[model samples]
Target chain A: MKKLFFYTTLALFFSACNKEEKQNYSNIAIYGHGGAGFESHTNRLPANSFKSIQKAIEVLNADGVEVDLQIDSNGTTWLFHDQFLEGKTSGNDCFGERSTSYIKTCNYNLGGKIFQLQELMDYFSSLSPKPKVSLQVELLDRCIDHSLLIEQLIAIMEVNNAYDWVQIESDSPGLLIQLKAASKHFQTFIRAPDLTSCINLCSENGFDGIIMNNTDVSVKDVERVQALGFKIALFGVASQAEIKSALKKHPNQIQCDNIELLHRIMKQ
Target chain B: MINKGTAFILSLFLFISCPTFGQDSLSSNIKITTHFGYEISNVGCYGNIGGQINYKKFGFGLAYILDYSDANGLDGPFGVATTLSFSPNHSDNKVINHFINLDYRITFHQRFCTFDCSQKYNKIQELNIGYGLSIKIFKRLSISNTINIGWYLEKSLSDRTGKTISESGSNSLINAKLNYLIAK
Candidate 1:
């Protein structure tokens, strides 16, 4: 009986050391969420910061990045996430309530400087090899003039020649409609709350795709959405298990918070 | 606020120094043990340190754990655990002792926030039940391994957006411990 126990333990130890099966993830695109994600404590760099974005693209070698863009009072787009800047920065008002001069002076309590959308576009245009990375920009609609915001965004895209590599996402159907009307070259996606709404919105409005939270959708839901001919992207993944589950759903893209984990898993 | 690790360590020493219950005078049946181990769970792995007091077939223990799984340095969640165990063959004098246990742990997860920002603490309470076997390896040292199924109850404070991220679920934990008999 003792020998049996010893041999059983030995066998289990060897089994644990066996190589894990490698999975093929060539079809899935990995995008860093708000640069590297919004972990309150785990993230080294603040989300939506230029440093985080640069690390996600240049160091992590992610497929692309999903950033939050808020239009200030001056109608210049800024990369920010919160509806109000009081908690994360020294500023007290919303981005739309502040001008370019005020926004530029306001510093993130996390140490990095707040950046303009133009800066990100300029960085992309300046890349010599033109890094093959797509940028999915989510519009944080506050108290801003939608028409002016759209016009300014279109001008930025045109000046940087970013229409082909940049995609826009928003929860507001009205904004998407205006964008599509303004430019046929723009690729728009609806940030849907559910599978049914996603399908209905994409099919009804002729949106290019849908973006949903990873936890809100299932494997079958992803398959069903893809079966309907609309691309799907899942976000809010933080751990290895969540990443693996998101990959299993086989969404066209994943806006991951843990870019390193996603990159390692994809390599495996 | 007192440091969580320091408070737990102080409490552990106080618990060890307290006299045993009941005055039956069979002092030999009472045993004090100190243990250090590694625990692996679905969420992450932790380094565990604690001590236990056993009387006949029943034992009680307290442990402090530090998480070491993620790349965020040692800023991962730290936990305090209390366990009650029953060993049916504790007095059999055999080389192996098999036990069943119920464990409750509370882990504090700090939210990401900037310096001087009002940081929120997310607390996760977990209840676990498991079986373990300890084998005597030396005069007063033994090695043990336990496998547990934990039901985690998570309560998260709101983020800057006033949205709470809920991660309530069940996971498994496996522990390997090296124990020393301090008193018998």
Candidate 2:
């Protein structure tokens, strides 16, 4: 018995660092990150707003949308992408960085103030589809009371009743693990850069999936991670050639910066 | 108690068997190496700087690499790696030499933080084994290249999930280094 166990361990160490097999790739997901916000381009709606969110869903026909999430000191959750308001907003500083009162009244360059997650939920409720979306929340390493942060995020999602379609993503492994601990069904993912790391992390932890940047991942990488049963989200798309290359790879999800362009390309 | 004893004995045996364990303590060399590596499985490139300390056939080294921004919005990724190598019947010499290696790497990347004013970075750790060939040139310099393959265990990921992640097919793990003999 000891010999058998020893040989098994040896075999795994030598041969099982990674594995791959052929699988069909017809069905995949397409998501518009930050509502594919390009005000100068086709969609006139501002990014991360109700207007663009709807446009991304109805006009662009994206399967889902990736939204930036920030929680203020008062525990209010805002849905914007940047760390600061510079270049994105007409405001002087960060929306969540300042007082909640300031965030509520603050003006933005894209045409609106920092909106709450409840408003996003209400808007989705008004729609027929409720727009499948993922919340890419930033994990502030060294932040205090991680348990409290998880509680607050869960409470917000619960009150908004967004538990069904909303998923959560972060670059921090610790944050993602805590989230899964809070709720097994609250789907979580890591913004994975290394294929080996992502697979090793997600399968060992409870992460439902991983998001890989297009530059760091290949078509074959998508297949391999997916084979391990972790959903693969190909993110940070810019040019037409990159998206074209993404299509050939057939990842489980594609987070597009140019929503309308991606929609058009996918349709063709 | 039995498990602990067994583990201690095993470790002691391994340590005593190290290549430099019985060699003269005065015969040690130090080298600094700069490397550029590319991982073709996912199509990424990196630049690295490494420092090595050796006593006869056994050597240890540390390396660091930082990734800049790319068109795909992947940037600010950095890694620090440590390596342990032992020459297989081939220590310092004019002929070709072979070395076996055990490597550990920890990588970090930037992420925006919510609910606070501070910035945060996430980390990933990996372990790999390597094989290399090296030769001396110019009497004071050496050029070496290595190929490595091994499994990685991402922190919190494997500890929490209790499962391992695997990659498919062969991953390109090639690196070339130019070592400048710093001390002897």
Identify the leading candidate in terms of lDDT: 1
In model 2, which regions exceed 4 Å deviation? A1-26, A38-44, A141-148, B1-184
Writing each residue's lDDT as its tens digit, candidate 2 over B57-151 gives: 78888766544223221123567778899986865655578898887677664432212323344455556678998877866577787888764
Worst 10 residues of 1 chain B by lDDT: B111-120
Residue B179 accuracy (lDDT) in model 2? 71
lDDT of 1 by residue, A112-176 (tens): 78878888888766654343333444454447666777788888878877767888888888778
Q: Compute each candidate's TM-score over C-alphas.
A: 0.59, 0.51
RMSD of 1: 14.0
- How far is A79's C-alpha from truth in model 1 (Å)? 0.2
TM-score of chain A of each: 0.89, 0.82
Give the Å shift of residue B117 in candidate 1.
Answer: 39
- What do the candidate models score in CA lDDT, each in turn? 0.73, 0.63
Error (Å) of candidate 2 at residue B51 is 69
DockQ of every predicted complex: 0.03, 0.01
- Give candidate 1's iRMS in Å, 1 decimal: 15.0
